[model samples]
Target chain A: MEYIIISTGFALALLGLWGILSQKNLIKIILGFTIFNTGINIVMVSIGYVRGKAAPILDVIKPSEAADKIVDPLPQALVLTAIVIGLGVTALMLVYALNLHREKNSLDINSFKDLKW
Target chain B: MIKKILIIGLLAGVGLIFFDLFNAYQGSEVLGKTGRYYAENGADEVGAANLVTAVIVTYRGLDTLGEVTILFLTAAIISFVLKFRREDFIPNRPVRITSELLDSASQVIVPVIFMVGIYIFINGHLTPGGGFQGGAVIASGVLLMIMANPNFGISHKVIAKVESISGIAFVLIGIMGIFLAGGFLDNRLLGLGNLGELFSAGVIPIIYTFIGLKVGAELSNILGTISHAQNEKN
Candidate 1:
């Protein structure tokens, strides 16, 4: 079931990439990037999950001796870091998008052709 | 098309070679058992049930400090991009609203959302939520207010104070860790009390609180700047 979810996420990510590549709308491209980012985060977190296991934090009320039963905390930390970085990047991108809107008066990627050969 | 195929083939070949090299190093003792050892001993030493937090705040705290610096740099860059330096400015006309009910509903919801963000940040160490999550939530609350009440601009002075104070506090906490625990960002300064407790992780919670506030302010400022810029252009 986990593998299936991950695979579907991957598929959606690929679809997002396709959207980014094919779409002319800047908003669509941004949305596509978000979709891709979400997929990657989900896949990473899923890889760290262990069936029937609680999060790595020791249960103070009910301690367990089985190490294998605890889900790895490393990926969660990494994901948290990734999510913050993603927010920063997205904020920067939105700022740039606003600038683009100012200049071109449209949210179309194709319209941003200043550097095209 | 042919070039794309060639590039894909080359990438696959390189990936395979990389995997092979990784496999060769997997069983090698030369890699050392430092990570495993740390993983085993971390919980007891740092008194943090969250091994990842232990590693981040205790074992490799300097790196985390550097990461926070990077966040600071990003915030600086954003501020530079969105700086409002003009001597004279014209405020945009207020957004026209049709429904009094919607405005009243938003006024009620905004404060509740802000409280939720505070709750998330305060209880970060004990739960799945943390500084970043809470910060973003707070920013979203600010964003909600901005959207619902266009005239209700966040006080620039308040945001500036929050951002600067949080940034300073983060650095001071790191320095305190260094002074109290023989290393920068050391988690042992706060007695390393019983694990799973709210105050157990010492500087982790403190660092995270600063991080949350800073992130929240920076994000909301970014959003505000973008919207303001759009309004000006319009």
Candidate 2:
């Protein structure tokens, strides 16, 4: 399960990277960015996965026994934080895309060559 | 042609690394020391049944604070950059009403959905969910209302009030922790009521309540601004 998850996540990240590097449409690039974010989250989550362990909820078992039974809470906590921040970044990027579209009347990012050296 | 080859080469390098990682990743059979510590002592130390909640709200609290600030600023910037003239705004074209039944059904269902969001956040410490999930759910409920009635609008005043008050309360509670408990954002501000109970986690539920309200308000505010701007541009 862990192997499958991590491999799939890596594949997704690669797909997103390809989209960003190849796609002309700004929106496609943004979609790729989100996919990449999701892939990173999946990898981070699977990294912390311990075989046959439950979630880190103390309600089901005594606190002393929780150490062996529970999966790592640290990665879950960090990933949750990362997901929230990723959403914010994506929203900001989208707004920027909208503004660019308004100014240039084009969604194709390649059309904006002002930065090309 | 060169760009394509270079890209392929880069992708191949990535593929190789992935293959290597995949081959080497033996699933951990033991929790890390910190994970072990949180799992064992979190209930007694933070009094929260959910260790993830304990980690986010109490252990790594300062990080959560910074995260919410990032959300607040992103929301502020989105609205700022996308400001549109209301007088010049063109409303959405009226789509033929698909189902009177669906529209009426939402009236009952939306409130229930909204309540479920509230329940999730309030019981965050004892459950799998926390503030962010609940807030997103509430925002979806508000969004459903928007779709059902094109003219239906949330008062910005109410949103702003809820946002500011909760944000203030969150900060104040963190400050109160300085005096009432150990460090900043400490969960032991009050007595750890009871394990696995509604109010068992001191300050966690309160903090999550504030977070849920603030996040919901921010998301709704973002949606409101975007929809209005799109209408104006169209």
Please name the candidate that would achieve the greatest lDDT relative to the true structure: 2
True contacts kept of each: 0.19, 0.88
Q: For residues A3-61, what per-residue lDDT tens digits would candidate 2 score against the true structure?
A: 88998888898898888888889999999999989988998999999999998887777
lDDT of each: 0.67, 0.88
Candidate 1 CAPRI classification by DockQ: acceptable
Q: What is the lDDT of residue B234 in candidate 1?
A: 42
Tell how far residue B162 is off in model 2, in angstroms: 0.7
Residue B139, candidate 1: Cα error in Å is 1.0
If candidate 2 were superposed on the true structure by all CA atoms, what would the RMSD be?
1.9
Runs in model 1 lying further than 4 Å from the true structure: A60-66, B1-39, B83-88
Chain A superposition TM-score per model: 0.88, 0.96
lDDT of 1 by residue, B107-224 (tens): 8887887788777776665666666778888888888777776666667688889889987887787788777786766767778777788887677787778878887887787767
**Per-prediction TM-score, please?**
0.83, 0.94
Model 1 clash tally?
0
CAPRI category for model 2: medium
- Indicate the DockQ of the complex predicted as candidate 1: 0.28
